[model samples]
Target chain A: MSKPETPPAPSCSQLFWVFTRIALTSFGGGVSGWLLREFVQNRKWMTQEEFLNGLSISQALPGVNVKNMAVWIGYRLLGWRGAIVGFVGIIVPPAIIIVLLGTIFSSLSRYALTHVALTGAAAAAVGLSLSMGITAARAVPRKAVPIAIMAGTFIAVALLHWPLFWVVLAAGLVSVAYAYARAS
Target chain B: MSEIPHTSLLLSLLAVFAPLSLVTIGGGQSAIADINRQVVDVQWLSQAQFVDAFAISRMAPGPGSLLVTLIGWQVAGFWGAVVATLAIFGPTTFLIYAVAHMWSRNGGARWKRALETGLRPVAAGMILASTYVLLQAIDGGWFARAVALASTATLLLTKVNPLLLIGAGVVIFVGLHAISLA
Candidate 1:
């Protein structure tokens, strides 16, 4: 059964505050999931398909995925202004806090324990990062060229220590060329 | 570079971070190694201080790329932070905005598909590479490595919150330190 009614659009401030709240509350990462729950499930502001589509585009494009996603959702719901709200909501509040924390950490730099706690936190955060990589890797199609590009990229950047600009540019050219040929 | 006037330093931060923003695909992790390199090359911060900033960014809320904000503050002051933040985040904002606009209006064009499909592998590769670099740079030796691996597993397999895992890591390291001292 097709649904007959679409939900009314949320105001720009409503959009901004939601993003700001998510930015403020999301600790230790997983912001994308939070976004999905808020827009797709909780408020029904955006459909699941729309959210997923925006997510894929955000992931594939340059720039921060969350910021892109925020803009994507905001633009869809409201327009240009909504997009700006999304950007500010997701970034500004947290930027302020991180700077404050940095200030405190600088003064507390003498303590060995501060560094130790930071190290521990950093290590555990790797779990979040690696898990994300695995998820992305699994999304690649089962084919030789894509797999090769992925592996080549890792080697160039990680093992070989090639500069990222060159690696991404070179590998992206090859990968996109291959996709273009395959498409035709 | 440090001796440059305030406005100039702010511009340089904007310059450094703006281009890096375009390369920060796949959740911003892919850009960290390059960002570290740029920060080092520019003499904005020392390697040790950069790592410290990275740690602080990870520990703080919001995007990990906030490391630049921390970097700016360390190098200059309040406006430095604002400028660095804008530099890192502003240019790319236009990009995604344009893409978002076109996507909704046109609805799944061929080039769009090509771009998304083409970039996926590169994004994946970059994430893996950045993860490796981070692994090499973090502290606590084997214990740190173990926690990272275990945390990875838990995240992949379970629904536990990441903050809890990071807190547990801090507690474990502190406990280990106390035992070694005794």
Candidate 2:
């Protein structure tokens, strides 16, 4: 059941700081999980159902899911201004850090140990991607057609290395059509 | 020496990433393979440089797509970073924003539900596919694979922070390396 009273909308500055924190603190992905916790569980700016709907839309759309999500949450809370704040907050701060980190690491690149450490870190980081993937896969509907589409997509992109645009377009259209037909 | 044509270099960065921007479905991770080809195979950066940048992207905070920003910086200094960042993250901003706007309107329209439900599997698959590609590309051999797998299992079963896991990875690898030398 939903809360009886909605929480007051977050200020654009509040929204910006939240996204900036998520972008800055999230080391190994799962930014979406961070978003869910921040907005739904903590702030209660939006209900769980509302958050999930926006999440699905974020995942389905092109661009970074978290960035799309920041924009979505921003738009929902504070219209166009909120969206821009979300975008800049999520991107700008971290962009500077990455460039700084890159410069520092490139200088340290001569050491074999530097690479070994990064390699280990990178490997662990893959866990973020893999776990996120497994979570997403689990969210897919449990039907033969949808399952097959999911499998076909995995094979095309991972195994065969097909372009993602076409794969998504083809699979998305078919899946959407199937859902549409079954809906009516 | 001002050998590198500033305008053309910036334009080239834009050209490379702008179109890729629109096609980055299931998040920016999905674009890595093409990016590797364009940046490495096409000779913008050598394989060593590409690998370094890739590792930096993975290790860095924020979006993994910031890899493009790093590549641009390596290729063309400050301006390259700006252009590449815009190219990758710019075009799709409008599309998602518009959809979010449309989504705000109350609707139980059949097509809306269908669109949401239909895209789920595709997005799931793409995320998995990108993960697989990343696993293959990573270095450190079997050790890396094991760390990744353990980390994945830990993430799924527990609510432990991922930064801790990454730190453990660094400590473990360095420890193991020291022991090997001794």
Candidate 3:
């Protein structure tokens, strides 16, 4: 039997521009989900299984999922050139926005209207964050161990006001132990 | 008020982003609690100011980490914003590029998979922890709690874009402000 051939990789320039569009337009939150839908599901830039695998790896790495995805996808597409293009695409739009907002916000600082708008924005941000938390919690493998870790950590930090570092360290140790116990 | 010297502004921007870039091993957003501890509690910026920058960053497009630029802007000015933006992204970008290059050449190794498996839970826990911290900081009144709850519900129930929610909140705030003025 003949072996199936791996599909041709996307060109560096194509990957660069596609990621650029994602970076420029992905507003408000869950950019990673949006990215997956667009690049993997819709465009078939990657298969769904590959995207999920990429996501798992991206989340496990030490960067924003979107940025990490960009890097991984870039590397997958055209090696190093693709990676650079993806990184630039990811950062450039936000940099521009920040610069412009920085200029405008300073000039508008003393305005009462500005403060009112900001207050509303803050309220919305809190809501958005809460929503993000719920979505993320839903994604954790629905197992007793992970759930317990989640609940315990939430209580430890939210109710008891433990330092963040300690909460993270404690959760990490517990998770590792749980995994170890399960394996053996 | 005088403009901060360009050099000092640049130095401060670097000061903020350089450490954040390195320590943010998992991404800039994950470093938020740490950033808040260092900036807000340490008096680099006030709590309200941090909240303001964060809100603005979320409202706008692109990465959440870009809030560092707003903080820089508040501390200094235009030049500071530019420098801070570059400082924050520049090093991280370079590092990611180099790492990607190496990973690609290595023909997809098992070490990468191991690293991913380890970091997954840690990143998730960090996000959960950050959420809790933010909740504590922002929880004050019924209105705030209500808004948060409503937003969360909307996010969970529908595919409505967050910008719409943010815009609606702005409108509500303005309306409330107008009523109070009256």
**Chain B TM, every candidate:** 0.89, 0.83, 0.82
Candidate 3 chain B, poorest ten consecutive residues by summed lDDT: B113-122
Candidate 1 lDDT over B116-159, as tens digits, reads 77889899988888887778788767888899999999999998
Q: Please give, for residues A1-184, the per-residue lDDT of candidate 1 as tens digits.
A: 6773688899988999999999888876788899999998889987888899999888888888888889889999988889999999999999999989998998888988777777877888888888888988998888999999999999998888787877888888888778876765
Rank by lDDT, highest first.
Answer: 1, 2, 3
Flag regions of model 1 displaced more than 4 Å.
Answer: B1-5
Tell me the tens digit of each residue's lDDT in model 3 across B20-103: 554343445556666676677547677867776777887778878788777767677667666776766666556556665575
**How do the residues A1-184 of candidate 2 rate in per-residue lDDT, one tens digit apiece?**
6454878898988999999999999876778889999999999898888899888788777788888898888988899999999899998899999999999998998998887787777778778778877887898889999999989988998899776667777998999999888888
DockQ of each: 0.72, 0.66, 0.43
Order the candidates by TM-score, highest first. 1, 2, 3
- In candidate 1 chain B, where is summed lDDT lowest over 10 consecutive residues? B1-10
| Candidate 1 backbone collisions, by pair | none
Best by DockQ: 1
Q: After superposition, how far is residue B8 of candidate 1 from its true place, in Å?
A: 3.2
Q: What is the full ranking by DockQ, best candidate first?
A: 1, 2, 3
Worst 10 residues of 1 chain A by lDDT: A175-184
Q: Evaluate all candidate structures by whole-model CA lDDT and list the values in order.
A: 0.84, 0.84, 0.68
| Model 2 agreement with the true structure over B1-182: per-residue lDDT tens digits | 23454798899899889877876777887677667767775688876567568767877899889999999888888888888999999888898899988876867578777877887787778778877877777777788899999999999999898888888888888888888989
